[model samples]
Target chain A: MGAEHTHGLHLPGQSTVHRLPAHLKIVSTLAFVLLVVATPREATWPYAVHLAALMLVARTARVPAAYLATRLVVEVPFVVFAVVLPFVATGPRISVLGLSVSEPGLVAAWALLAKGTLGVLAALLLAATTEPRDLLTGLTRLRLPRQLVEIMGFMVRYVEVVTGDLRRMSIALASRGFDARSPRQWPVLATCLGALFVRSYERGERVHLAMLSRGYAGSLPVLDAAPLRVGDLVVAAALPTMAAVGMGAAVLTR
Target chain B: MHVPDGFLDLPTSLATAAVAASAVALSLRGARRELDDRAAPLAGLVATFVFAAQMINFPVAAGTSGHLIGGALAAVLVGPWTATLCLTVVLLVQGLLFADGGLSALGTNITLMGVVGVWTGYAVFRLALAVLPRRIGSVPLAAGIGGFASVPMAALTFAGLFMVGGTAPLDAGSLVAAMASVHTLIGVGEGVLTALVVGSVVAVRPDLVHGARRIRAASIQAAAPAPSSGHRA
Candidate 1:
């Protein structure tokens, strides 16, 4: 389990944002995103303010803007959908560079692009600063159900192993001249997935037996018992509080 | 099917979030019954396996490809309640860690993919299993039917959500038609994947499959001597 998979998006740093407790950072990120979502889409200034604030946090956390921008590729599909909206959306049409586009569609596109980008950036920043295990621990600390947290822990632990199994199976398939080019070849792919499932299920049983041999009852032991500090709460609240203030201002100026 | 933030109105997002949360709560209770000490870890592995399996995309059409949503697959391998929980965990991880889905729209994603996908797929799977032959051979076909229907069902659910709270003013009929048509193609890919996987598992270890448990038990009973005929007063 100590494989190279633990460092998911986490960039090691001693920055203030990175030093903050995981639960605090998680809450802060959630609150910030909620504020971003809650902001009126028509208020362009609020979005600008939100972006600036996120940038400030990124700077403090030492996460490169380029790194954040590169990860935005995940939103490419949504971006494509947003780009198409202006053409297909109904309602008041306006001429843009000789081609008529829907006015409401333009607004919808902007809202999706701006809000979606901010949300992704916020989540990326959280992942960048916090270790994957710490995030799970944070959830546990935040009083998420113990069973759910345990399952998530197992998921994070075994994802790489299962992925390795999938890769090996795919290689085996390819070695046998399987190209999966058309829908007709889906049966082979499905068989691969099936084999993977059986392998994983058997591995699961072995893991359970191993746990039982180690005197494992139902729950895993909690290792991190550190309590939250008051200072951490203040630092965590700063971003969301600023966001709230910015949103209020955006509404007022509107 | 990952709806970004601001695509729907706040009220609708919140409402869906509430529904998603309750569904998860119900799943938690239901999963407890299914996930004994032996199956709990397997349930977790099922989620992880689904996550990895979802990464593998298969071509569905000339220019398009789709991956397994794994609702029916998971519901068949594990139980439906645990399947919902597995999907929710995967979606949670994807949204929070990978930034693949929106935090604000997490509710919508979970509701559409996890709840609707699992329930619809499981319902169809059960229906297929009932109508089809009650044997190990039929498990995969039932699962395939379930998986095939689930994608479009989830798409329809998303279209419905969009109709209620879509930011862009679009014709509902066209939206549903477009979503259904495109997703129907995706559904074919889903069906093939689900069938192959379920069929393989049924071939190797039919006892491990939740959906095929009845078949396994019935086969066992048939193999054993009939107690009613053997026993005497």
Candidate 2:
């Protein structure tokens, strides 16, 4: 599970998008998503424009189109749900391939699907570019409370260890002739989970004790400096500006 | 449970963010007290474990798959304060680094799955524990009920948000019913996993389980030989 983080998903490129400040990008991501949400279902062209703009941004950012497609597939559930809306939606019926589907419903479904996919893609692009450590720094700089950030740092560091613990427990259970396929083995699995919790608890206690011994007050020391430069501001401004314009136009039209 | 962006309307998303940020703030204050030197790394481990466990999706219906929310499990194992912080980290990393959740919808996701799910599940678990037999084994029952209940609650929250910003043709009543129905089955998987995890922990390091700590201690006290006449029983 930990190894999944190092997969081929993140391709290093010296692109401008990859160099932007995480905090600004995060703000932009929010604004962009709001713009997508604000776009009316009736105005198909606005959404199309939004999609085209996103593609252009991705292209400029040097995000591989193939990667975007792969990522979009993960939103398939929402897509399926959107597809069903046309049939179930209460509106005037229209014939398509010898079946009746509501015109408004079809339009609504298309909007939902398109908006959801675009939002997901924008988020994916952000994640693809930013490193987790730097993102934490940016959050702390943005006045996200120090304590929360510290806890997040620990979680990022220890998530792998916990996963390893689970994997080992499962393997040990398997070795003991406990097959999870049958109902009878469920008790064993339950027992294993309980054991895992206890281990994690003990680990927490030990960690706490160690921290106490080291003169740890409530807050942790900030790991690195986060200097929000002029460049960061400029890069960050671009996305939000686009989002504000797009969303504002959509709202005005509606 | 990992809601991507654009699922909810702006107002709902913003409101949820405010609620979630407050919850995170309160939890941070409490968690700071809990996180001595040793617990910091353990917090990380807990988050990672959750991430891994979530990947192992259990089939709800034939084709549909649902994964553990892990909020109740985290809260019961660690204290609710620490559990909330742990979940917040997992969600943040998943959203920011792994692209598992949407960046913009982080607030709503944390509100539903982190704060609401854990507190609701843990509260029910504590109540159930009070009514059930005073035994270490009873933690699983509490966990199962907690897990079962939280999923629908989160789904309902999602439905509420959807109603506010929905672009689709879904009616509130039908959406709620459909969401609750699908998530009810998902809750079965959640219940089984949470119970199993809680039960196993109670077996070995009962002191580690925040929810079961009292029962374990009581059981230990009960097992001890009757105190001398001068000694307190």
CA lDDT scores, all candidates in order: 0.86, 0.73
Provide the clashing-pair count of each candidate structure. 0, 19
Across A195-231, the per-residue lDDT of candidate 1 in tens digits comes to 8888888898899999999999988898875787898
Instruction: Kindly list the per-residue Cα lDDT of model 2 for residues B1-233, writing each as its tens digit.
Output: 56766666667778888999999889876865665544456676676666666765444444555567898888887778878877888888777666666666789889888898888888888988999998777888998888888888888878887787665566678889999998888777788878877777766666667788788768767777565524433
What is the CAPRI rating of model 2's predicted complex? medium
Q: Give the TM-score of candidate 2.
A: 0.88
TM-scores of the models, in the order given: 0.95, 0.88
For the record, the alpha-carbon RMSD of candidate 1 to the native fold, in angstroms, is 3.1
Best by lDDT: 1
Interface RMSD of each: 2.6, 3.2
Taking the true A–B contacts (Cα pairs closer than 8 Å), what share appears in each candidate? Answer: 0.70, 0.54
